[model samples]
Target: MRRLLVPLVLVLSVGGSLGGCGWAGRHAETSKPDVFQLQGYVSVGGAASGVPGTPCLAPTSVPDVVAGATVRAADADGKVIAVSSLDSGVLAQASDGFRCNFAFRMKNLSGSRPSYQILVGDRPAQTFQTRELTEGKPAVVTVTASS
Candidate 1:
């Protein structure tokens, strides 16, 4: 009886340790793809520029102008998946002239989508393939807005 009890205790101990390994938790984590971050720049051009043919006049006010504006990401079916807001704007020199460029970042975006449609503010959506965003590189998008 003592010998039998010793083996049974050993078996139960081994089984309990394996159960505590948390296989289910690890599987749940592996089942989901890693989330990606989307970083972009919003360039306000046309009449929205404080000064035509030059950089914005009041650089500080650029942030106020774009405040509360949102950046949205939609799947092929036009389902809105994630959203972010413009961070802040700064005057940047451009070939045509100068423009107010605002930077933004959207986190926790799934890379499972075949493609994405990005819409900044009220501008039209721009389509991008999944590879463009998930290639282990920073996906910098430039959105042009007009007044």
Candidate 2:
């Protein structure tokens, strides 16, 4: 009976000490920077050129300016964390006869899976994700108007 009691106490002590060490290590790892800035570009595009008198599709271009557009970032729980609006200049000249660029920036993000949405006036909202947005680089998100 005495020998069994001695070994049990020793095993418990060692287990407790190891568990505490793991907890400390996990806390240390979380001390690094976790927040980041999410920046990107949103462009609303559609068929610009067509046959003068018939139905002909032209090359893709950013001519359909999505005015009063607001971009938002939401978390896993659908909580909005950041937002930005498109500038008039960008909207006016967004299409360079090709793809136009509108800038958006959201700061203090957790660098996790974030949902992105472009809200345009009375149009079906263009929704997507931030998984493709590289760090330190502006991501390009193209939205098309529902016709």
Candidate 3:
């Protein structure tokens, strides 16, 4: 009985020591910077006179921009709201230092246009409305909300 107790205690001590080493090892690993980000971009596209319509607006300082491109978003009914474009410079002022704004632009694609409600994650940040788009020029839309 005495011998068994001695070995059991030694085994337990070694196990605990190994567990601590594993934890330290994990912390030593280099990882990406943790940050809050908003990113979106256009997928569909068109062209004119054998030339591509502005494939996408270059990202700038606008809240409605995404990776220097324009894209669109929609609701279930498919109502357009606002145009989004990439504006990385503007988002640099986000209250949350780690936050960003990236989205696809949206023009009045349907008969009825929807109102805009900017979001960050699931939280509503702002709201706005856009006028009807008469020119075929695509409208920009940005979504700085996390998916």
lDDT string, candidate 3, 1-147, tens digits: 999999999999987896775543455558522221223322212111122222333223332334544333444444433445544322223233223323343433343434334333222234334232322233333333222
- TM-score (C-alpha) between model 2 and the true structure: 0.47
Which lDDT value does model 2 have at 62? 35
Q: Is candidate 1 or candidate 3 better by TM-score?
A: 1
**Tens-digit lDDT track for model 1 on 9-48?**
9999987886686443455464644568776666654324
Off by over 4 Å in 3: 1-66, 79-85, 101-147
Order of models, best lDDT first: 1, 2, 3
Worst 10 residues of 3 by lDDT: 42-51
Candidate 2 ranges with C-alpha deviation above 4 Å: 1-30, 46-68, 89-97, 114-134, 145-147
lDDT score, candidate 1, position 8: 100
- Per-model TM-score, in order, reads 0.61, 0.47, 0.23
What residue pairs are clashing in model 2?
Answer: 94-100
Residue 62 lDDT (model 1): 36
